[model samples]
Target chain A: MSYKDKKVITIGVVRDLTGLSERQIRYYEERKLIFPERTPGGSRKYSFADVELLVEIANKIEDGVQTHEIRKEMLRAQKKQNQEDVRRKMIQGQLNAQFGLRKGPTS
Target chain B: MSYKDKKVITIGVVRDLTGLSERQIRYYEERKLIFPERTPGGSRKYSFADVELLVEIANKIEDGVQTHEIRKEMLRAQKKQNQEDVRRKMIQGQLNAQFGLRKGPTS
Candidate 1:
């Protein structure tokens, strides 16, 4: 359920999994949409998260969403995720403080 | 503090924060160690996580570790993190089941 393995899944596997072409994946990279890591031998490698992202991008493009618009949407989503993370940490900190946990955020 | 902002910070800011040269950062990217996202216009953008990774890579290189070794270590660390995520999820699932939560992983 997690795609935390960075630079392990090949582009070919991503292509197979997402039903996307190599060219389309590379184009997404060029559009600054997905950031796949390269192998030491210079082959592009993707993670499952990248594959999911590609499918989402492909879906949006099919719905007539521009690549630039997708990029903006990604930024907004990233910002929202960041805010949620902060909020979670703050809640955790407050809970810790309320429980008199010595290792609370402020401590 | 979490560094979850992807592709928001610039390479210059990364360089300033990590005390690493641009060439060194690019070299790490070339070595397939760090994966920075590119801007739409093609400038490299880094997140705070990338900056921290660069600093760690720099320290390792200073300690005479090869880039390939660093890459292997990264893969190992990533695998460990993935396992941890799975373990956490399993624990969450068990807790949810115990609490009669309807939205457990299996449910």
Candidate 2:
């Protein structure tokens, strides 16, 4: 899955979309939850994906999960998902190697 | 989607499993994060799901999401998920009504 997005949103836009205070947003960054881009002047510039992540983080916070804990779980879950992808790719590669598979070729 | 579970664990187990202090756990409950079942004497009895939720909450906290914000976001997310579920069920019911769907029936 691509984490990149085209639109670059400001912190204010994130506040509007996720209903989070600027302080909270910055604090979340301090905690390392979501990392938006930085302008040359050191202003925060968020992507669409960052917006979604803020929303998700807000949801988890509302659910009574602690700050540090959320980070750990998300990272763990992400790692697990990445591993699953790698595993699937490895299997696919093996299958192709054995069967002499090629793109757009089915017989 | 079943929130119910067997094996009711005590606070001690939750603490051990989640690496959360008792005070933090109780504080999380007061903040309305995880609501385990209460015994007649008012002791907490948690299910596996509750334990998992606590773990998740811890992860989020580690990730830098704030407390109240997390609660708000989680609630919003849950409401959205519930709405999606209702929408799906409504669609499925309509389709079944129109097509006379039956259990274990396939052509």
Candidate 3:
């Protein structure tokens, strides 16, 4: 796991970082907008990435965007990104094949 | 917009391309999973990108993933990807500054 993926930050820290209330954070979690890991004692532990996502979610909500619409837009953007990645990799693979490289393609 | 974003394909063509029933495609639209443009005569039109997205949505549904969960996962993945892109651009900017480049960093 990367440093941002480590779930070591508490909800209070996230609340301070994102300027969102505790109840609001919990509500986002209930709506499946954010997923924080659960501690052994059942406390919530959020990652750095989750904090950034919460800030983004809050910004969209403040701009009058619904949570569901935000989710859908994200999905569509991700689908486009995945397609781009696949296309890039395919081109890289063909380039490598043409250059007689076994595996790695030169950056 | 790119070629993939042009909403020129009809639902029937998308059905032929994706093997999805018309009703199923319309249902996904109703659920706000896909957004197709409309013609002056009120015909639904989809883009090449939308067709690809529909196929991806179908695969996730067939794999027993709930639509909401799939959307949430996509949002999180997209958030991570945006962060990566920002980091990459920042590094590129720093490299350009070091090289005294005024604009357009070389790829």
Candidate 4:
């Protein structure tokens, strides 16, 4: 599907995808955990990314991690992953250099 | 240091490691988010795993995931990761089979 036309899932859809109850999802919204866009009729619409994030949040909770703590951990993990991605790109660049496709010593 | 004697950290230590206030950590415990071991003197003793979990929980909260929701999301993420790891192992096994290092015909 085109990016803009990609389905904007309803709250029920998000609940099903994340295996969370409607009440729980609403409660999370109230806590500013997720801010799904609202339709003109005031219906919540979630994106696929939102559903994935909800799943991640659910996993942390099942591990007995606290909500606030989970927030911090998610941010840290995201940052760490970003850094790792950059490092991987650097390594790939080095590999390319070995084939004389790029010019640079390993960083 | 040996595992057992590696040091059972105090609540203060946990707070420092998790960047959470003592009250917040205690609140999480009351909510059954985390259950650190207790000392004979009724002091809370956190393990390294507890610290790591706390860090993860903190990340979720910062990401705007709710407490109860975070619990569910964390659980789901953990299951997903476990499943992914198993899938990766299976793929690895298939690769090994291609080299006659395993006894399977690509299941």
Off by over 4 Å in 1: A1-5, A103-107, B1-107
Candidate 2 vs candidate 3: the TM-score winner is 2
Candidate 2 regions exceeding 4 Å error are A1-107, B1-4, B101-107
lDDT winner, 1 or 3: 3
Chain A: TM-score in each candidate? 0.83, 0.78, 0.77, 0.61
Q: After superposition, how far is residue B70 of candidate 4 from its true place, in Å?
A: 48
lDDT leaderboard ranking: 3, 1, 2, 4
In model 3, the runs with Cα more than 4 Å from the true position are A103-107, B1-107
Tens digits of lDDT, candidate 4, A63-93:
9987788777767988999999999999988
Error of 3 at B56 (Å): 46
Rank list by TM-score: 1, 2, 3, 4
lDDT of 1 by residue, A75-107 (tens): 999999999999999998898779855754863
Residues B1-107, candidate 1, lDDT per residue (tens digit)? 33244444556556666899999999999999988876556778676578778889999999999999999999999999999999999998888779865754863
Interface RMSD of each: 10.5, 18.4, 19.7, 20.9
Q: Report how far residue B21 has shifted in candidate 3, in Å.
A: 58
Give the C-alpha miss distance for residue B31 in model 1, angstroms.
35
Each model's C-alpha lDDT? Answer: 0.79, 0.76, 0.80, 0.70
lDDT of 3 by residue, B20-43 (tens): 999999988887788998766677
Once model 3 is optimally superposed onto the true structure by TM-score, how far is the C-alpha of residue A4 displaced, in angstroms? 2.7
Q: Give candidate 4 misplaced runs (Cα > 4 Å).
A: A1-7, A78-107, B1-107
What docking grade applies to model 4?
incorrect
Give each prediction's root-mean-square deviation over alpha carbons. Answer: 13.0, 20.9, 23.2, 22.7
Candidate 1 global Cα RMSD: 13.0
Best by TM-score: 1
